[model samples]
Target: MNIKIPLPASGGLLLSYKCTAACRHCMYACSAKWKADWISEEDLVNILSQLAGKILPSPYGPDNIGLSHGLHFTGGEPFLNFELLCNALEIASGFDIPSVFVETNCFWCTNDETTREKLLTLRGKGLKGIMISVNPFYLEYVPFERTERAVRIGTELFGYNAIVYQVEYYRRFKALGIQDKVSFDKYLQLENRTDFARNTEFFIMGRAPYRLTEELADLYPRYPAGSLVHMPCSPPFLRDWHNHFDNYGNFIPGFCGGITLGDCRELNDLLKNGIDLEEYPVLAYLIQDDMLGLLQFTVDRGYMVNGDGYYSKCHLCVDLRKHLNAVDGFKELKPDGFYSNLA
Candidate 1:
């Protein structure tokens, strides 16, 4: 059977995988250790042009254009490359793309003047909003003051457009009176909790499962390798509503890390021709029979199942992809670092 996203309603463009901090639970495993490869101006133009031509699969609001469909600039952190981010916003504006925003950890917000200056520049370049990341993981690297400053200034400028990714975390950080970077352990101690993973929202893929196993294992019951066989992959994988395209040209469907539907450079062609399951065996198995099917396929190819039971189907899925990725046979598992950075 062949499959395609048809049309994605919303998506993000990853400026780069390089970040100021390496959050342990990051879905894409973005870190400071990543290479400084960023999206080229030409590639950005090509992507935005193609995106500008696409119509939403489901229309919303006054315009049905995909370019205005919740498109945001993201990365290991979009703010890391200030110039590229500014260029991207300007280019999107040239294309008449509106409602574009940027996601950030606020690590660069050193003071009120700098923050306001940067925000004003981006807004002038057609930035519609900002999503400030605030959480224990980010608090481990960025000062809470910077995040607070960003929120305050951003809300002042963008009004309701400025969004705290998780206002709950913002409130918690304020209540704690956290001023600077702190270790996750120390934050947990201050919160009087032994674990925070159970309360956080993140996908168990990329470096997350491997790096956070200890924090999550005890909280959730583990199951043997075949435990998720009967479970089908989530419906989101078959839909194109929420997705991300990376600097490396891979189109990540439904935020399923390490899984690439195809190259975004040829996105129009892929959408027109549809994906041949024969070319993407991992996605094929997953679409046909879920993670269990993928496990069976890989096991036949000599994948060794670890003795430790999986905490969820997502955990097992990442484990299976990690093995397939290391083997270097599957072309669908992408960005290489998604698996290699598991350490």
Candidate 2:
């Protein structure tokens, strides 16, 4: 049983929410216009049950289940699915699973008592961490007050476990801020090394696709593609971005009938129907085989740079980003127990 998430990173669950704010460059285009589906409390919980290491096939032993780290939740805004989100946290807490984290745009977080209470709710769920996306591009759509409120709630709720990521991708790229690009000479001497800038291809997520013009695509090549990098691609995350239900529980995105390649509901169906995500070829490359050959492959192929060398890390597919954006890039790719028996 080759049961494993291809990338060596944490097992993540992506839940897309429909937001009131619609930005120009949205990657998944998670907004009122480009709405994806929201997973239900029932389905999301069921999946967690599977991840608790019981339902899913376990190539390694049971201890490997709890030994795994990092259960990340990202989306249009996790807060949009407050009820289900809460369910997930509380369940993870019940299981004593650590690293229950979520990434958000801070739009729904507010000074309202309900919001404070919700943040407080996560505390009970082993919510050891939270990442706030503070991209400058959101300045036009997201109110700073919302982010400020989220930060306050985060610190009060998750305490020292909160992290914030830079969101001003367009401006940074527009300014050509390639500080990481300056380290070319140090690692290139090794003939096979992976760094943040080496093989990175620039991928625009969250509001970028709509705003991306022909002129920008032309400009994308000017950036550097670092070398020898391996990271998670978009299989899992893409699989999970679905439609948000009405306050009543109806997925409003798309026809709610069609299925995208990586959407969660469809993935679930695939599972029930006997298709295993672990068996996907692309997934196998990143998550299996001790996680080193992939890194070396990236190094050998000169893909360690962000976007095939021309774009930023965000531009790559989600799974691709997971593998590349891993802490320390190549080195962070770990060899889980599942690969211990490999030759």
Candidate 3:
């Protein structure tokens, strides 16, 4: 069956790369050592303005005819810059966007009273939902008590429906012995599991491949050789439900996490009219699920692989992009900091 890729209805703005806690599994490799400034107020306003004028693709039809759709604010730690976060939410609220959400690790929830006050401040501005990151990786830096406090406060302020707990799959499996068909279901059925509990799979990219893979090798599952090439990337292509804009205004397709489609600041048209994936060299390869083809394409273009084996397909893909950027000046493929941890 031929599956059609839908255009994006949601947009995510990455406020900054600076983070207080450096989690091993972070896909963006965000850490305190990673120096980058927050998205300026002017840029934030411009991005939100563009999002407000966007028309939802035909797949969504007339139901969303003249409405501002989904908008999410995320970062290494959004709450780290409280003032900027509040400002961005206020701007988004001005657009009357339907879903204005924020993703955070809840590290700032030092106490229930303070947390409640902060949540109230955000809610008053325009924040609709809070997606909390919960797992062993985050627990190392952010105490479970802090996350619990935030969740309790969030439930009280935003209601259970508006609160989301993003639990990592591997951590849940490792900690609770949740694996395979029956055990996974058992984990979901646990008494503590709420309706808003969302199980997220870890991508073997960025910090995960370098920092966490070896220690958890036994628990990690391996794909059959060549399976990755045939595996479809749903979020960036199949569903095409969302795109992430970095602090610099680069539009990153969610599936190909590293590559940038275009700089929204340079291409204001992208804000009015969304990116066309087919035109991008890297994204076009991903849309077709042609990993091997991409590697070969890069090789033909004079790119070379650094290692004999990779932790996963994403590892290989990132390496290839790094080589392309270093040797051929494909700077738009990925941020230079993505290769910083590489030896």
Candidate 3 lDDT over 1-343, as tens digits, reads 2223334567678898778877777777788876768999999887777666452422333212111236678876889889999999898878766567778888788887899999899889977767777655675576566776777788787674344445353345345553222322333354244421245555777677677665556555555335555655533343445667788777676645567766755445643455565556666676667888888878887876554356677777776776776766564576666566333
Q: Which ten residues in a row have the lowest lDDT in candidate 3?
A: 58-67
Ranking by lDDT: 1, 3, 2
User: Per-candidate TM vs. native?
Assistant: 0.92, 0.50, 0.77
Give the lowest summed-lDDT range of ten residues in model 2: 334-343
lDDT (tens digit, per residue) of candidate 1 on 36-108: 8999999999888777745242244312223335678998899889999999999887886646788899998
Worst 10 residues of 1 by lDDT: 57-66
> Which pairs clash in the backbone of model 1?
none
lDDT of 3: 0.65
TM-score-based ranking, best first? Answer: 1, 3, 2
Q: Write the per-residue lDDT of candidate 2 for residues 1-343, one digit (tens) a residue.
A: 3442221223445565455554444444455543446666666655565445322211232122211245666655677777777777777666654456776777676566766776667666556667776543454556666666677777776665566554343234235432222222322332232322233333454334225423245444533333223434333332222222222122222211111223233334433453243534333453342234444444554445344342432333222323343432332222111011111
**What's the lDDT for all of these models?**
0.79, 0.44, 0.65
Q: Please give the clash total of every predicted structure, in order.
A: 0, 68, 0
Better candidate number, 1 or 2, judged by lDDT: 1
Winner by lDDT between candidate 3 and candidate 1: 1
